[model samples]
Target: MNLDLLKRTRMYKGYNQYQMAEGIGLTRQTYNYKENGKSSFNSDELLRITTFLDLSFKEVNEIFFDNLISK
Candidate 1:
């Protein structure tokens, strides 16, 4: 995952970690762990985040799947 891009995008969209957690039905700590790469986001959470962030498909790919692309 492109963690930096994800964080930057979230901040750019005016969302805080707490809001992201709530939006995705996760606790803030869980979300923090996911964001910090201590844990991974499940597909449902990824979908929720995409919707919540109003992300385009390209942005989603860049933030969530760029590593896959490179490899």
Candidate 2:
């Protein structure tokens, strides 16, 4: 997962990991691992994150589907 943009966006929104997680109905540890690429996002989780971050579909693809696009 290419989460650099996510991190930057989160910081710009003044949301800490806990805040982001809670906003998306996830635990801090789970969000931490996902953010660190220890685990991938399931569809539900992805949707939740997208909603919480107010990310457009294009922005979601750019950040999370970059590899798929390359292939």
Candidate 3:
């Protein structure tokens, strides 16, 4: 996961670590590690996070894939 992107976007949207973890069905510590780029975010976790954060396709690519392609 892109740690900086996740932190910036999540905070920008008023989501804390606890809420994000709950939304994605993960423990807070697990979320923290993953968000810190220590752990991997599998497809399911990424999907849940994208859905919870209401990310568009371009945003998803930018945040998750670091692709940042123009929409």
Off by over 4 Å in 1: 67-71
Pairs that collide, model 1: none
> What is the C-alpha lDDT profile of model 2 across 1-71, one tens digit per residue?
57888888787878999999999898999999989888887989888888888887677877778646642
The residue-level lDDT of candidate 3 at 29 comes to 99
Error of 3 at 10 (Å): 0.5
- What is the per-residue lDDT of model 3 for residues 41-68, given as tens digits with 9 covering 90 to 100? 9999999999999998977988887885
User: Order the candidates by lDDT, highest first — what do you get?
Assistant: 1, 3, 2
Candidate number with the higher lDDT (1 or 3)? 1
Q: Give TM-scores for every candidate, taking all chains together and pairing residue i with residue i.
A: 0.91, 0.82, 0.89
How accurate locally is residue 15 in candidate 2, as Cα lDDT from 0 to 100?
94
lDDT (0-100) at residue 57 of candidate 2? Answer: 67
Candidate with better lDDT, 1 vs 2: 1
Q: Give the candidate order by descending TM-score.
A: 1, 3, 2
